[model samples]
Target chain A: MSFSKEITIAKSSVPKVALLVLATIFAFGIFEVGFDQGQLFSIVFGEQAYADLYIHELTHDMRHAAGFPCH
Target chain B: MSLFITIILLSGCSAGVIHGLVNLALVEPYLDKAIGIENQHMFASGEAKDTSQFWAEYYSYRAWQKGGQLLAGAILGTAIGALFGIVFGYAKNILPGNSFAKKALALAAIMWITLYLIPFAKYPANPPTVGDPETILLRQMLYVSFIAISGFGALGFYQVFRRLKSKRFVAVLGYAGFIATVFVVMPQNPDAITAPADLVNGFRAVSLVGVSAFWLSVGLIFGVLWQKLQPDRVKQARFQ
Candidate 1:
């Protein structure tokens, strides 16, 4: 497929999708950069890995909220 | 400048969608495989080990749900990384030291790696000091971290590079989009859900460090990779 087509097919996001991602990333960023460091349940044992996972999962949840078709 | 940014964002969204599809089709099975290892370890261990130990007692960790989480993470991260890169690029042209998103990703990644990815400890609730649970936890944590750090890094960076051709929100959308794909496609859950014995007292400083560092690295890798992978369209737009 052409680059545009591939990108469109691979990474297209609706307005809702964008909003969800923005929301989740902001939450994730706030948590990771701020509160996660505290002694509560938010531990950064596997920093990038978990942050990466959090971002990933947050996206997943956000996607579901956005009415996107799941894999 | 506004015209240029609009195209880059479009490219980013397209990249996100593509990433989701790819994860659903190609990467779901591997998640299942990772789950298998985690399951096997949990099953074989009879002593009722602490769930909070942080890593595999033998060498695995997982959930009962399908490999949806990993897929979701992959797709979503790819998009975010791309968006961040493009925004940074755009800012560079507009003003001096204006690379906001790019800086955020880099700082976040490095912070994650340093805080969570290091060799660390997890103390057992009631240690006979025989098995040295801390050591085991460290190894397992490392293994799990490997997946996120490399996966996020590569995927995140790739998205950044694609921002020139598509919608800005597309990359942002991809983070959730790919995750949605994984949630629907995966066949099983990977978590055991029991508390680890190590956490009986609390998450020791060493172990927590490992956790933070791992995620930090994950963010960084994905962030940078996305930045580097932008399409020429994005570059042209950013310069415009």
Candidate 2:
């Protein structure tokens, strides 16, 4: 297939798109749990202490439950 | 093709379960101690109101927490294994000499070394109570940059080795030199870890052990499964 035709075919493939979406979600989830330190949403909204604390508290139990290295 | 993906996912899930169980049995005690220490510090600093109540709750929810850890491990493992499967599939097409099992094991070892061991040693994970909150972003950036450097550096070394195939000793020396350069040039962590030395060491050791167990299991299970599922492939690999 030509390069453009290949691109078109890939873009039209539902399974490919679904897999891409799933992979993206999985990567984001890993980043949030493993590296974000529970400040992901708050970080996107600028540095808001209350928001960060709120999100952290909300995820605190889950983090600990998952055995993440949270304090 | 789907069968291959299923095998990868199953292998990864098994690895993840092993990882979680290992953590629960061997590493959880040290981790609990570290958490207790952090909470004690928070209480002493007036950041927490009731450490006793917190400990009681923590103990009470032990079973639930263990279950959650296992579930998280399985999910994460499946995702990671799927990615690994895709990469290995592509790589096998390009590089055909080795068996799938050997390739998977090699990739697993390289990943364990570069992605986890080196980067983690440089910027070990700290408890939330350990570092200054303001420096969290900078710390994370530094940590991630180190991971990138380590990963890309390893790949670069492999490329160079492939290019200089005739001089294997020189290639080995070149890779060693590159690693030494990275060790020296990588920026030191600016923020001092505030956790007690013992606690920090204990936590790092436990975490490393858990991760090592996970990767080892992933490598072994995937290798065995791939070999079993494709006996013809194994025969080809032997001839190669």
Candidate with top lDDT is 2
- Best model number under TM-score: 2
Going through the candidates in order, what fraction of the true interface contacts does each contain?
Answer: 0.01, 0.04
Off by over 4 Å in 2: A1-26, A36-71, B51-66, B93-99, B127-129, B169-172, B231-240
Give the C-alpha miss distance for residue B223 in model 1, angstroms.
Answer: 18
**Can you write out model 2's per-residue Cα lDDT over A1-71, one digit (the tens) per residue?**
22221111111112354356446645764565445543666655666744455434433433433334344
Distance from true location, Cα of B184 in model 1, Å: 41
DockQ of each: 0.04, 0.09
Candidate 1 residue lDDT tens string, B161-210: 45646565565456445534533443322222243443312323322332
Candidate 2's DockQ is 0.09
Q: How accurate is candidate 1 locally (lDDT)?
A: 0.36
Residue lDDT tens for model 2, B141-176? 776677678767766766676577487567557756
